[model samples]
Target: MSDDVVAPVATAAPATHEPPARDITDGGPDMVQFLDADGQPVALNEVNSPYAEYVDAIDDEQLRSLYRDLVLVRRVDAEGHALQRQGELGLWPSLLGQEAAQVGAGRAMRPQDYAFPGYREHGVAWCKGVDPINLLGMFRGVNHGGWDSNENNFHLYTIVIGNQMLHASGYAMGVQKDGMVGTGDPERDTAVMAFTGDGGTAQGDYNESLVFASVAHSPVVFFVQNNHWAISEPNDRQFTIPPYQRARGFGIPGVRVDGNDVLASLAVTQGALDRARSGGGPTLIEAFTYRMGAHTTSDDPTKYRIAAEVDIWKKKDPIDRLRKHLESKGLADQEWLEALDAEADELALRIRTACQQMPNPPHSEMFEKVYAEPHPLVEREREEFLAYQASFEEED
Candidate 1:
């Protein structure tokens, strides 16, 4: 081939190089940590540590309640997964881990504050005082959502990734317009929280929400539960910069916390939400955590990741860590722990029974809410559906 004929330019096959190694120290500068993997208490720095005061505020009773919440939430999640496997639920998104992240954030919010959750926020729901059976109803196909969002100030679970950020931001703006921010009255002042996974940060809505919140100084906290995987894709594919750092680009302050450490999660979330309620503007919190189970009941983690990695994270089990800490401090004993286990078993039984007893909605129920006023097409369809059902009945 002549030089003028330049052989068809060979393009190197897309680089199959593995992701770059992440630097620990610099990669996570804002990581607010209160406990180590071994459940040992770590000293707090008043100047640099964002969560020191929050962690210091916890008493023995609250510690025990946190443990109980963790246990019960785990049990609820486990039962939901089992019910799905047994064909009782259409699907289940197990919060097998990350209990600490959800519970801590959930517990920190004031009753007046509002929460917008991703689908896998069972622990948060538990903290909001939603009945466990109500959660199972949605999975069982009996209701669109189990609880009333207004009643609990907890919005329905949002399956669409990152959409809740927009909703929460809008709600926060509404709260501001209504003069609910910086009232110095905890009972009247309100802030909004939006929950999302690490992958959610990649969505346009997330950025748009941040822009609006930052510009308006809306009373909202954007909480990203960085479970390391957005479904099968790892965090590296979504973005190289740490999620918390990304907030700086949007002009919102951010902090990263050891999500597995419940106390840290609680403290960080509380701090962010408090800032929002105080008219300080939106804040972003990246709770660095892991997903121990499949993304959902339909997923198989073994296919994409190795067992050794899971084993490593297992050692950092949130529940186990907290339990050890409590035991070591003489805050709880074997007897109390065993009693909690018995309560968990009873809760599991109740969940199983309630899930099985849920009534399936009638076929016509779908048409009932299609329109505020009766539409000709919907009426015709409803009639046709009922006729079809009648055809299945025996002739008398």
Candidate 2:
């Protein structure tokens, strides 16, 4: 291991009923953190020096922009949660606390880069130029997915756990075959990013994708947002070793970053992506963060986790940290902050209005996209379904 990378220390597992008490604030010595929990800058150190140049390249305007992204993304999450509560959506997965992780990684990609995201990557979608309303349409049950994946190079949200990793691996291999990797031409070189949560690491698909990506030398990065829970299950239930450490077994370089620190997230991800574009194969980035909300509208996080744990993580809120940094650095003032908050409110109103105005597609519309060309079997089923509906209408 390089001096920058620290090896994992194994600890005895606690009893089944009583899980080990984790210090939520600490991301361990190996985790790269450019900003401390209080939003103060951490001076360049061994673990973070490799990625400092990336952060240094960001200008004052860009720093403020990142802070804006963080604020708006959190607002988006609040709206999504509210919409679900009002029965506007069938189901909604809240990205309440993972905004920095998603936004940082999203902004690191070039125009040609592709992203395969798990369902809750709203922040990534936003950074990739995907409209917030488009995301809401899916949960509202009005459309399969609201946007064309090809339009923005952001794939439709994948609902199945870890499935998108395989898709991303295959896509990366395809990009390699197309001579997109290691091309000195910046416009031609491409890298793929696959996003998943902590629970996804336990899936066979995730492991298999890594194997293919390693042997094929595919240009891809696996970003695991270790939000500390896979639904109700904690990290202890997922793996004995952290995801980044396990990347070594697959012959890939692994790094852990403080997910709440946007600068660290952006810098580290940019480095990994640069490595991938230059034909360095894949890297696994485990972003140490927390899910401050329920797993979904259907979940009750309070049932499984204690309020104290949530309170501890709240002190490290990603948005609050970035705002503090901006204020301390004189990059923003009260008036500027208020204006951004107003913009967020406007965005929330727009999202709410767009969602309520979405037209529900006719049930028969499902059959339209089942095949590119007309098929007798589908036609038969469509007719049968319509006839069944007609019989109910007649009775009424």
Candidate 3:
């Protein structure tokens, strides 16, 4: 009777959707590194690194600012990792090895510029004045989003891969309509930057964004942080060509940066942002960097990525190179370094407290921001939730 009543056995599990093919030359091999593994700036044009005439506009003060930002941002990232390990948070995406890439791109942004970030862009969030606790809650399982997208001129952390690129494009379209481009007045000029990864480049959202940005001449920058691996998938799995070449196909200029070299990243980002602000069309900046840690605290890279790959990236550690640059300039005295360490410790403690204090959202909270106006469906669901919660037996 059971055999007769049973549903037919499935022949195969649903076929898995394969990821997009990898590009062997989408972005140039290795990366466009300016400062070598040692952190000293290399001779321009000697390596594959290209120069923007605009780079000449930068000064030492700006370079130091980039350094400070990278240091603090990395500290914030590490603090987040520690919080995850301590069980104060559920998960944390490490910016462990991409500080220079974030700081350089962030510092290049004007106050009027807007940024769209993926979930992993905490370093960029820090650059936009977001409190690190905001990032903590998402991983802590305490809340969906910690900040308002409009709050810091930064959009909410988009969890869907490459989705923000489209949002950023839409925002850039709005900017174009508002006449933000070619305003000439620095105070009135505006540009948009969207951050994603190598894996995201395969998403149609990324390609679609390029199309919109190019056709609209939208003042936007597609910042691709090619951290070498998209969770379990290696860079090779994402593209057959390097990602930067995709930008050229979109009819926009593209640049590659030694994401580990703060100076170079700074130089390139500044140039790109400036170009966009001044009515130059969109550019895609492939920050050639590495993800030194797991994709998230929940990931285990050793399963798909080899130890040698990570070791190779270790030589290009962004923070180390920046520290070297700072030391060369006599800026990293023991006192200064100690003070930074102490500050990081204090910041870590604060993050721990905040994470621990993050309370569980109320049952009604789920219905809070789904719509601009009251929604009958949400109201019904919230009522049902409340009634369901009340059904629980008395607590001890």
Candidate 4:
């Protein structure tokens, strides 16, 4: 298989180039929000208000689907955590509370669009129809990544933090050079979605990607899910301003949306994608959310942050917000919610079973997939490994 790559309101219907109303000068977190902590709707400002229509476009059925997606995504994450704890996996990077930011952006993309994700983008992988079982192989030590990225246009997760940014930018450049950008035909044209964490913003690769993308006017959307903490180091240590604002310095339009607000995330991402497909160049979207769990199975948040902080973010849970909105809007009832819970339970079971059933790769496989063309050195290594295995059999 081949390897491949991959918002906001304002008043008076502002032009696409206009920036959202946000002040990062005071080091305070100011983001474009369409929903509050209570799951109550909030009025959008002039810059962000434009996205209200996109949010409005989601029907009742789609809303319920989004909620279901959120629940299942969380279940997958929780199950992964449990598996890691039980020694079924070497490690797992839990997506935890960033469901809306992922689901919202994921659902907004067309099938033709590509996604380049960081290790924690399980929700995005789910949205792209990547089997959850496929993701387990990596942490289970079976393979680097289980799925064929070419099949779904979702690249294998980049565990190197900011490394995916360069790959994504290069892919976008290829898309432009191949005459794939600015095509009026919606189905034919494509855009790239590059994901990274707040910590990744500090990496040179990330900044370099922005520089290349900006100069090339690549058709890509840089999505940074700023989950507050970069493995215990707070956002303050990373930058003076928010991650999105950094796009402005590179001459790329940027906006920060409430990552917990599913609707806002979907709409804002959709707008950015639309612009990219229409040759508007790259846009950076900062999803301001929090990481409810440790960075990975190896981390412990208690040593650095307090439980009270986690509790505060819980009140702004993405799944709960959408579920509340659905209930209040009469789009879902207690019975439907319960069914969804049962479905999530089934999914969790499936994930656990599949993860356990994953097979370890053959020792010789190490040298087999190393290159498309065979080399004497790799062949020699493979023969040596096979001979080594034969020696063990002979002893038995």
For candidate 2, list the clashing residue pairs, or say none. Answer: none
lDDT by residue (tens digit), candidate 4, 1-396: 001110222111112212323321111234667777667888767756878889788888998899999999999999999999999999899999999999999999989899999999999999999998888888897885778998999999898989999999999999999998888999978999999998999999999999999999999999999887789777656776567666778988888788898888999999999999989999999888889999999999887766655765687788888888888889888899889899999999998998888778887777766878989999988898899899999999
Ranking by TM-score: 2, 4, 1, 3
Mark the regions of model 3 whose C-alpha exceeds 4 Å error after superposition: 1-33, 46-61, 393-396
Which of 1 and 2 is ahead in lDDT?
2
Q: How many clashes in each structure? A: 0, 0, 16, 10
Model 1 regions lying over 4 Å from their true place: 1-29, 46-48, 372-374, 394-396
Query: How far is 310's C-alpha from truth in model 1 (Å)?
Result: 0.8
Query: In candidate 1, what are the lDDT values of residues 2-101, reduced to their tens digit?
Result: 1122211211111332322332212143467787777899786652365677888999999999999999999999999999999999899988779999
TM-score, one value per model: 0.92, 0.95, 0.88, 0.92
Q: Top lDDT: which candidate number?
A: 2
Q: After the best TM-score superposition of candidate 1, give how far the Cα of residue 47 lies from its true spot, in angstroms.
A: 6.9
Show model 2 residue runs off by greater than 4 Å.
1-22, 391-396
The numbered model that scores best in TM-score is 2
Query: What overall lDDT goes with each candidate model?
Result: 0.84, 0.90, 0.77, 0.84
